[model samples]
Target: MKVQYFAETDTLYIEFQDLKIVETKDLDENTALDLDANGRVCAITVEHASERTDVHRLTVEGIAA
Candidate 1:
């Protein structure tokens, strides 16, 4: 998993899997989810990320095998 934040667009993208997204589904005006061709979630994109999400800090838990 990975998370990316762009200062110019104020967009935050969180990738759940390493798959290429074939479709984007909008959850709302500022939130959208991405899906791969197999129907699994690929990532999530949030617009106006500076205002909508906390871009300054992030937390991750658990151990990667």
Candidate 2:
């Protein structure tokens, strides 16, 4: 898993897996979900990250695996 924030685009991308994205779905006007061919989530993308989220500060809790 990985989380990346691009200052230039003001976008935040969270990748769940390193898989090929088969389709992209808009969760809202400023958010998008990426899915693999198997319909599993690949990543999440947020636009205007500064306005919607605190990209400057990030905290990760309990591990999934």
Candidate 3:
């Protein structure tokens, strides 16, 4: 998994895998979810990231198998 924050656009993108995104769902105007071909989540994109989320802090636990 990886996360990237775009300071200029105030956007944050969190990717779970490098798979091709087959579908996209909007959780809200500023948040969206991306899914892979099998309908599994592949990534998330948040707009207005600074105001909507704390981009400065991140915690990662044990790796997924």
Task: Judging by lDDT, tell me the better candidate of 2 and 3.
Answer: 2
Lowest lDDT sum, 10 consecutive residues, model 2, at 56-65
For every model shown, what is its TM-score relative to the native structure? 0.88, 0.91, 0.89
- Model 2 global lDDT (CA atoms, 0 to 1): 0.97
Give me the candidate number with maximum TM-score.
2
Q: Write the per-residue lDDT of candidate 2 for residues 1-65, one digit (tens) a residue.
A: 99999999999999999999999999999999999999999999999999998899998999878
Off by over 4 Å in 2: none
- In Å, residue 56's CA in model 3 sits off its true spot by 1.1
Q: What is the per-residue lDDT of model 1 for residues 1-65, given as tens digits with 9 covering 90 to 100?
A: 88999999999999999998899999999999999999999999999999987798888789598
Q: How close is candidate 3 to the true structure, as a TM-score?
A: 0.89
List ranges where model 3 is wrong by over 4 Å: none
Which whole-number lDDT from 0 to 100 does residue 1 have in model 2? Answer: 94
For model 3, residues 25-51, the per-residue Cα lDDT tens digits are 999999999999899999999999989
- RMSD each, Å: 1.1, 1.3, 1.5
